[model samples]
Target: MNYKLLGKSGLAVSELCLGTMTFGNTTNEADAIEMIDRFVDRGGNFLDTADVYVSGRSEEIVGKAIKKRRSDIVLATKVRMTTSSNINGVGLSRKHILDGVEASLKRLQTDYIDLYQVHVWDHATPIEETLRTLDDLVTSGKVRYIGCSNFFAWQLMKSLAYSDASRYVRFVSIQPQYSLVSRQMDREMLSLCLEEKVGIIPWAPLGGGFLTGRYTRDEPKEGRMTTKVGESAWINRASDQNFSILDAVVEAAKELDKTPAQIALRWLIQREGITSPIFGASKLEQFEDNMGALGWEMPTEIWNRLNSASALQDDYPNRFIEKFRRPFE
Candidate 1:
């Protein structure tokens, strides 16, 4: 139920953002409504979705559910993902940027989106074109703030530099897949956000169910992952290093009287410069389980224990720099 500022913006978003990716795809319309109610009941005001999710059904479902209290929930959606076949149907071109907002706004049943994000980097388009189009949106009162998702360090830096010089709308947040099993963001993206004062809204805070502890080394189950059947499901494609950490997550959760999901969420919840995490669930009970991640803090020893278990090996420049780091000279 805690809240944090969305980057440099004055808006205060809930610490846990209820992600709608699972709303229309995994659950039926009735169940999606129930999940939305449960999230609102839990004091969550931030809701994140995208135009491309579930082929745009996600937005329709969430837009219908939020009909009663439109102002209460902070709605966020994204563009830059293909929504149609027309030449102007995708990417961050000025035409697509403006057209995408119009379509997303109509689908969400809202006059203005609280935050509109670029879903992916459109290397084909100029950063200036995207930022200028977004700035126009802000000026027109169609979007409150702007953000980017799945952007690399250099891409984000370049965009920011362009915005800084042009005085266009700047990105207030970055959404990336950050979790116990994935420390890839820790290298450059994390530090860049830290230094630039951008909010990190981590997606897949549970590592796509890898840290849920149900799919253990011994008792792997059928319905643990996002898939319905089969072994080589994308969920089971995790590296050996990831599963090895799951064992430690279970042990620590046992000692702390918590679920691995809670500890996984708590780790990011406690990490510095994280604004909010976008969490989703296929069922109502699962939604309740995700909410349990709040209302408690993990002990320090257990924190370090989980950290030691899931650490990734240093790569390239990181390894080289660490090898010659100077204490005093």
Candidate 2:
């Protein structure tokens, strides 16, 4: 396991972060603790959870699992999701940010969070109010760093600009959905993070198991996608093009003698500006299998093949710009 500095921050984190969304949900406390133990044994020091996951039960499980070695882990969690029926129970408003951090700290059994992130864009609150609240958290030593998740290019840039003007601690990282089959981040957010020096910790790095090569067209397996069929993203991914991409992954895996999950993760880990890929597992084998992605290198040929198979076409003016640059090359 390798560690990289998170964006421009001095903090170092593992290349692969253990995600605990499954904790207290699909996995019981004992299993969750075992998974985390294995992860730590494998040299993983980063763990990510959200307060909203499993209605706060996930946080409780993670808290118990990491309590013995809390000092050695780079613990991260998020706010901005609805935690209660109260009208002030959500959003990035000052009240919620203050209340949310307190709740997360209590649940995680930690005095300071390694990284505290805003889970989603909250347009209702003023950016100044939100930034000020996060700044306060850092100043009070409750949060060591701050980040944002599920933010678009514009929203991130706007927040950064506001932070600069107000002299607030800028977000050191951004978490977005990115994978071999989900390359939408390559368009704008990737470049934005690169230019701004923000570390990217990608969640759903396998496209919610789409790139795992475990699902088929006729009969999807009983997994996250199958259980969440009502979600439009999952429904939309069950397309001919996506399956073709999966086939590309399977073919490469077969040629290299690696699991499709390893191939997908290795490719994402090698991408520029990605600090870590947050992966979750319900079973211990699944967690162990994902670790396979780290031991060796994927051949360049296979990597390129997977890249081409999942590459998104250049959008809009960029497509035209590529045409213009072709002459110079």
If scored against the real structure, what TM-score would every candidate get?
0.93, 0.96
Residue pairs whose backbone atoms clash in candidate 2? none
| Residue 14 displacement (Å), model 2 | 0.3
Task: Tell me how far the alpha carbon of residue 150 in candidate 2 is from the true structure, in angstroms, after superposition.
Answer: 0.6
lDDT per residue, candidate 1, 1-329, as tens digits? 89999987899999999898876777888998888887888889999999999999999999999988999998999999888999778899999988888988888888999999999899899889899999999999999999999999999999998999999989999999888887788889998998898999999888777778767554345654646444335444366788878878888888888888888888888888889988888888788888988988888888888887877676889898888999982
Residues 175-226, model 2: lDDT tens digits: 9988876778888999999999999999988888888887888656566776
Q: Rate the local accuracy (lDDT) of all candidates.
A: 0.86, 0.90
Among these predictions, the greatest lDDT belongs to 2
Q: After superposition, how far is residue 209 of candidate 1 from its true place, in Å?
A: 1.4
